[model samples]
Target: MQVKDKVVIVTGAGSGIGRATALHFAHFGAKVVVSDIDLEKAQKVADEIVTNFGESLPIKANVAQYEEVENLIQHTVTAFGRLDVMVNNAGIGPKQLLKTAEHTLEDWEAVIAVNQTGVFYGMKLALQQMLKQGSGNIVNVASLAGLKASINNLSYSASKFAVVGMTKSAALEYAKTGIRINAVCPGYTESALLDKLLSARPDMDTMLKSIIPMKRYGDAKEIADAIVWLASDQTKFMTGQTLILDGGTSL
Candidate 1:
């Protein structure tokens, strides 16, 4: 249950919440596997962990592709001997105005492929390994939009909702198999993604703060801490649950 010495894989660990979680887990002594589409960014994170925390592995893989995801899992197992935890966190949120329903089918397909199918692939492969080991944890990174409808981005919301549903369904199916599955729904976190959104509409920054009780964005570390706890022994009795770290925004 302790994070120490456990082999953990975090996808999209190059920046934002993914990077924070990778560093946090490594700091706690987990054998961290940092996978991202950007090889340079992944390596940077892995280097930092190795320099400060002693051990880490960097791998470049696109989560949206089944073959890439399979290879990521295979490589991690080959290197670490066993996979203890898998964090499905790689995603994209390209903003599109509903007024412009003229959006291409390609864009919609790309978003769903990465956000929804990526999680599905990660869960499927991770569960396979965990079932063999008779124990493992899977923590998915969903969004607040998954819980409620977000204006302007219909595709992102739908994809995230799928993540939430998949998390619950997988948890029920594997409840007796010693593999725990759960999700963390974060809202308005300080990340590159959010920064891009805010830059597009600076007024949204204040508007968001006014709506949330906290009056500010949540930190990446806060989300990372929640993930670690959910993935650790502290939540052994919990599964198929979605932990919302939205600073009371959803309240």
Candidate 2:
């Protein structure tokens, strides 16, 4: 709960919120494991942590694949001796936003694989390790879209909704097992994902910012701070809940 010396694994640590979370954990003195589909990016983040005098290990694993996730966990334990916190933060969105009826099966499947099923795999595999240790914590990254509807992001919205459900249900099931599960729903953050979406629909930029009362996008470090708090003793009694950081957009 203190996070100091705790062993934490952050998926998708190659960039964006995932990268920030990994760096944040290491800054708090946790032994961090940086896992990402891209080894180069993962290693770079890990190296940054080490350079800052914090501890970290970089491991490449695609959360969509069961074997890769399993290997990620095994490698973490082999290096750190135990898994204390698991951040299921890896996710992906559709290439292009389209009408529900216009979306292809490939689009749906690809998003579900990485966004929905990927969380399932991370939770399932992480829970196994946590149960073995008799106690641990999980911080899932959902989205504002998960709680409400995103105009043209059908598959992404659906996958995120599933993540919210999974986090709550699993938290309830494991409440008494010393393993706490919670989720963070961030909205319109300044990240590569947002850049990609904006690149596809540049016109939506103004509309997106106008909806949020803050009139600005969130910083990745702010979300990372919230995640680290959720995984700490400050929120020890909290589980099966979502901490929304959407700059009042959800309001």
> Each model's TM-score?
0.97, 0.98
Clash totals, every prediction: 0, 0
Q: In model 2, which range of ten residues has the least summed lDDT? A: 1-10
Q: Point out where model 1 deviates above 4 Å.
A: 99-103
Residue 38, candidate 2: alpha-carbon lDDT: 97
Model 1 CA RMSD to the hidden true structure, in angstroms? 1.2
List the candidate 2 regions with Cα displacement exceeding 4 Å: none
lDDT of 1 at 183: 98
lDDT winner: 2
Q: For each candidate, what is the lDDT?
A: 0.92, 0.93
